[model samples]
Target: MPKTNWKRNLYILMVCQFFVMAAMTMIIPFLPLYLQELGVTDPQSVSRWAGIIFGANFLTAFLFSPLWGKLADRHGRKLMLLRSGFGMAIVITLTGFATGPWSLLFLRLLNGSISGFIPAAITLISMTTPKERTGYALGMLQAGAVAGGICGPLFGGVLADLIGFRMVFYVTGLTILITAVAVLFFVKEDQQKKEEIVKTNTIEDFKKIVSTSPILSLFIVFFIVQCALIGINPLLSLYVQDLTTSQNVAFFAGLAMSVMGFANMSASPFLGKLSDKRGTQFVLLISLLFAAIITLPQAFVETYWQLLIFRFLLGLCLGGLLPSINSLIRHLAPEGMESRTFGYSNSFMYLGTMLGPIAGGWLTSVAGIRSLFIASSILLLINVLIVKYNVVPAMSKRNTSTSSKKKSVANL
Candidate 1:
């Protein structure tokens, strides 16, 4: 394929990526509301149920992320994508049939256990894209995620109002099914067999990765970011209702989510590209600090629009953290191990997801909504300090290794 053609392929693959992500988020944004409708009324029960519903999917995803990556390495990325799409379709479709909170939670568990499309898509793009262009390409992929996140909640909320939450699941499932079919037919894979392929023993590989310096440290930051991001999610619908007192809360709630999405969408690429020039660690520290500063203002916001603006600002700061983490993993890991490393990365993210909402629920109950921003801000600031002095230096050492390898090749 011509060079230009390969770039076009990247774009095509990303569009598919956006669709799959939208399907994933469609169910997620409406989950807390759906649980309310399912008869979980007490504040504590609602909070716990919200965490259970969201965390269940992520717990499964975390458990399976590395395993899926190994499978992708063995069977081919396109095959992995197909698996992810089909799995999401089945599990998400089942969500619509859930009669109670427990049933919905069960489906979320199933959903996590089965799904892996985002990681699969990342793996595919990593394999196909040229080395020099990787940051740019991955940034584009991240943009698609931001777009999906931005649009999914807005579309999901509106659709839930129009068609009801159960029917929303049906639509999401069908869209994912289409993604599977699209990948099966349209997404081509490079058939060249890779050497040094290790069968995925997730626990063992997880240990190996932990032993690697900076990777573990990087994962800590990922965990923190995931916790901070999701800590607000279970409360967003409720908070919007409190702030706006609107009867049609879904539209405003969706807009609130879309604001963050739009900010992330706009900022991620620039941050990714900036990482290429200024170094990922530098970008990470700045983003973390920026996010921390912006988040504090959220605690004082009285209006929904003010909250929306602050959340958007927060998103801009957070937009680069994940991509920078990915760039660092790519920088540190051996070529064939990319899939596994990314898988473990997702697992850490899931751990955060599992913990964040649970913590958020308790905190919000005790301290109220204002505490969400305060807690997140404090954690982010701490993260920023850690990244600036600790993670960045370790990563710089790793990049030195990468630079030395490049110079050695140049000499040869």
Candidate 2:
């Protein structure tokens, strides 16, 4: 196959990500409704099942993320993308055929295990882009994913009303399959020179990186951001339920979610470019503080419009977090190991996504809506503190050393 320009390849990756993310997120607004169709009518049971269904794929993804990352590093990111695309296509198509709650739950698990295309795509973009442009590239990728999150549910709800949920899955699946074929045919990886496989065990390797103050700090900050962002996720449906008793609950819930998506979709690229200019750590600090303040009012919202406004603001705050994170990882990771470092980052992110719902569900069950805002706020605060204490100090040291080196070279 002929090679494409990196920008063109990035565009392809972005389009592919849109399809993959849309397929995943579109299911969210429909799951409870779909379960109702399957005869599970107990409100409490539905809530529990909803949490399970939401988390099942995340947990599975958390488990397999590193392995996919490692594979991407060794083989090629393009192949890994193919694996994710085809795997998701098959499993998501099967999800449409699920007969009951248990079957659907199983499909979600399978779906999570199979879906790591975004990480693989991110890895590819990170590899392909110049270091100076990494933030912008990652930001664009995040925007595409968020855009899918915004539009997918709205479209999914409408499609479900028009063509049924099962057919919606089929359509989403076929769309992704087409994307997979595009990747296989059109996208190309600039293959790296072969190197001997490092003999270090995974645990020891992880310990070494974690021992690095810079990389570890990035991990902690990333975890915190994911926690804060995901904290409200599982509760969105319940929040809508609290606001209004309308039978068209799913449609409005989707609209609420899409609003956030649109905000994030609009803001991520700009934040990413800002980070590219100002540095990732500075951007991260602002991202955490911004989200914390904006997201708190979500807990107090009494009307659907108020909730929509806060959710949009929350999305805008979150828009920068992931791009800043990926940019940091790109900066700190050693040359030629971008995929491995990013894989480790993905593991932590998946961990956060998995824990967020569980924590959100538990707090909502026990302490109520206030817990969502308060807990996420606390988490974001911790993240900001970690960045201030751990990350900035180390980055300062790195910058000082680089400056000294440049001066020494000039004097020579």
Clashes of 2: 0
Candidate 2 lDDT: 0.82
Question: How close is every model to the real structure, measured as TM-score?
Answer: 0.89, 0.92
User: lDDT tens string, model 1, 53-125?
Assistant: 7677888888888787777666777787888889888888888888999888788888888787887787777
> Which residue pairs of candidate 1 clash?
none
Question: Which parts of model 1 have CA positions greater than 4 angstroms off?
Answer: 1-6, 29-50, 99-102, 196-200, 241-250, 404-412
Q: What tens digits encode model 2's per-residue C-alpha lDDT throughout 6-93?
A: 7888888888788778877777667888898887899998877888888898888988776777777778889988998998999999
Indicate the TM-score of model 1: 0.89
